[model samples]
Target: MRRTSLLAATGALLLSAAPAAAAQPQVRIHDIQGTTRVSPLVGKHVADVPGVVTGVRASGASRGFWFQDPNPDNDPRTSEGLFVYTGDKDPAVAVGDAVTVSGVVSEYYPLSSGETPETTANQSVTELTGASWQVTGKGSVPAEEIGPDTVPQAYAAPDGNIEKTQLDPARYALDYFESREGMVLRVDDARVVGPTDTHRSLWVTTKPEQNRNPRGGTTYTGYADANSGRLKVESLAGGDFPAADVGDRLRGGTEGPLDYSSYGGYVLEANALGQHVPGGLKPETTRKQADGELSVATYNVENLAPSNDPAKFQRLAEGVVRGLAAPDIVAVEEVQDNSGPEDDGVVDASQTLTKLTDAIAAAGGPHYQWRQINPQNDADGGQPGGNIRVAFLFNPNRVSFMDKPGGDATTPVRPVADGGHAALSTSPGRIAPTDDAWKDSRKPLVGQFEFRGAPVFVVADHFASKGGDQPMHGRFQPPTRSSEEQRTAQSRLVRGFVDDLRRVDGGARAVVLGDLNDFGFSPALAPLTDGGALTDLATTLPPAERYSYVYEGNSQQLDHTLVTPGVRADYDIVHLNAEFHDQTSDHDPQVTRIQP
Candidate 1:
């Protein structure tokens, strides 16, 4: 429900102290320094400011260079410039070089953190034109001499208050490094804890110290060696640097080796950070049905909800029972529910689907039945509308629900972390779930059905959203944390499932349908077609009728129904009324008739 904006910057404007002076054509260092304010200037040209380079640190392949006024006492405003660091050029300015930089002060770009608000602190820099010269002035001293020495702060600490407990060295070292964020802290009596395949490093433990606040209130303080503490850096300027040893003095802000949490953490690389990881439920084989005629259809029942009041369950029984096609098997996506009354509230979608089955039979339609995989009670992803899921509706006369294999039949489904959770997988990418991670909800539902006299299998898939397309590429920027990869994996798993079925029953039939979160031509759909397992129904229609959703005022097809080669031969896939583009659902329905 929270529509993600793929826009690069949030369009946040920093208020400036005053308007640009009319007399000056270009902004000068004095103009920026004279004003005690910041402004948002997306495409403005500014003049160069000269200062002494106080610090130069290589970040990945780029260098973060900081500068201070020649007369620090006279000019209080500090300035800095960042440049992409290529190894070919010797850095013109060292720690003590005087350099002048001319570039526009730009707004910070936001980084994605699954389930967290995007973070903004680092700004982007471009068009660097500067000169550097060696300075004969006194050099800046290292950070340690400026402050008093103390024990390094450990990453994790015991639950008990630090003041009362005696420090246990071994356990202390193990826990601290595990809990601390990316920051530098001094440690005492530190020892090598473990070694990773890439580097050998030590985890140090330190005791807490008591300190007084500005109001003379006492508090506990921790330390780091040589002012040594963890500093989260985006990356090293170059690759494969030597690891810091156990006894090595660590400067609090000095960049160090990457940590486990680094991938989804604060210091992520610009290129890799804030991306969605893909994931999904992997399908298990179900019972095969006997040969018989069956009917299957896919519907994009636009945003079907329980009611205006999110608290009340919207009755879908009437709609399903009275639907024009009266499908024997229905794959409905975007069936919405929510935690609040104003939003799509707690209408049990499974129960609604069940009611619809009974309603259809009562209305002289087929005696249909249904099954659904509900998202977790706590899985609140979509915006104010609550949550949406795909449900399977089938005629009992056509198919029987088989117990999913390889798992306890009665065992309750568990809510594994979605791409939103960092601890779930280490792939550094998000893919849709292909397993039973959807015990709570927010996953595709699968089942086996008997079509009159033949066996048929179906997977009701509702992929992640391709909400906003990227301006430059005209493609939906996949979600952060490898989310696109997870979806890709889910597609592959579906293809594999279909392939396995064909292998078992030389001419087995299968159907895949719902909102795929992808276009007909997307790379994610390759697996389904590559093995000749599924054929897209949209391809049967003329170019004008292909799309089901609209973006940037243009209609695009995202909802689809695909059939296996064996199934397509006997069934005619039809796209229903989609021209209205109404609010009932974001997608129109597509019905398929299986011949006897």
Candidate 2:
């Protein structure tokens, strides 16, 4: 769980400072794991701690064994189980053997190898290091059962420093988990809320009735509504982890040691797995646009490039063509260049676009033409050298791109008065390319198009991603969203530019669409819809079908499409990729049919 292996930097230091062979304190496991979240006996020497071995991990990069005291102290604030980190050596222990352990107690704040407690906002894993054990006899401790009714409804207490707070298992969920940090827990008929990943892990909800969406997942509406009943499950003994989709049931029961890691927080390293029962989750497709309507869609074809596998292009093309029913215009994000990710200064994406469009044509869709402005070499901040940018793809027979020649990487696109309406100074141009709000981020591309002989200005945007922000389950309550500052500034820039377009013509048809990377109700989304210049279409969906992305079992929205008053739009967030196991991209593409 630490940044390094079991022999953590802090643990190695504590091991060297072990006390002499003097009489050590005879303490119980509950006294070591006090009422507070942090152990009071940290960095102290303990002798002859009694426990029974419940699980052993003698093989892997993380090798450890878990033991639990057979008798509980009748206090909910203390746990009986303990994990013995053997560093790289194997511990000769069995599941039922009783042992007396003598070692130094240390706190390894998993994942913050170089960070001290004052510098990091992460919880620590209290373990006994530099340990030697003696086999006493045979014993067993039945694992404590965790169920839907047992988990607290309150997610977090909003306390300032959670590490010093007393355990309140009757109130908050975070405290309940902390009270039983290294204990063995069991779940029966656990419902899968998040799909299995490549690292042999999946998420299951203890409370099935909380915030459940129509797609068999939990819905994350705002910051305070985080569902904390979700628990991560992984195999402990390198056995195969069970694979299941959303709503699938892990029938029978699954029992294991409740270990903590930096990746998923508290995890159930299962020694006995449950049977996987399929929930029959399926992908959803939307209907095609009507004859007199223009369809516009936004998709994040995840880091697509020519060097990617053919199946990647084909699958994404199939989603655009078949799942979305072939929208007339598509604003694609993360379109990498020909020499994808190779820092050779090659920034052209003609080959990548051509391949995608060809695959769409082969999938029985219309012939599409693409337009894009390549960014300066490594100017955008995606992968190190994968010059990812936003681009447009339009069906030539249905809509025509107004081609102008003055657009480049650094020039800002302008609006000009033409025939009592607004027109772009350069078609397929970047909006405020030199603005500080868009520094090292993908610039918004504004394209002018004519659908059914009417002027339509489309602004394609891929705003700053949500990196560098603290996790929802971090030590800080109501996690800090520092990344939203850049997105809010970028939204204001887009709002100002759209206002300029409307000033020229009060009835300007502007469709702003792409991966916005912020929630629909966030402060960052207010600027785009605050002044009435545009109406956010993401709010038009029902509560059950609102999200376009799923993260850690919470379905949420990140991609969006907004429209000015001149265009009458009907929005549909196609639920193809986000909910299913077979995903071409991590996001679900959304389309809007407009009648101008």
Q: Which candidate is the best by TM-score?
A: 2
User: For candidate 1, lDDT tens digit of each residue in 1-596?
Assistant: 01112331142122234555567554433333221112223345454455554444443333344444443223322122223122233454555555545454432232334322123221122212222223444443222111222323332233322212322323333222222111122222222111111221222212212121221111112112111222222333334322422122233333221122211122211111111111111111112222444657676554555443322112233334444346677887766653322443354565445544555666666766666655544352444444566667776665655444322222322212333321111111112343533223245555656554455667777765543222211011111223445456667766765665565555666677777767666676677788556898777764444655433222356777788885642323232222221123334455666655
Q: How many residue pairs clash (N, CA or C atoms closer than 3 angstroms) in each of the candidate models, in the order given?
A: 91, 0
Q: lDDT tens digits, residues 417-524, model 2?
A: 998989999998998999999988999999999988888999999999987776676677767889999999999999998999999998889999899998887998
State each model's CA lDDT, in order.
0.40, 0.85
| Error of model 1, residue 198, in angstroms | 54
lDDT of 1 at 436: 38
lDDT of 1 at 18: 50
Total clashing pairs in model 2? 0
lDDT score at residue 546, model 1, on the 0-100 scale: 60
- Taking all chains together, each candidate's TM-score versus the true structure is 0.43, 0.93
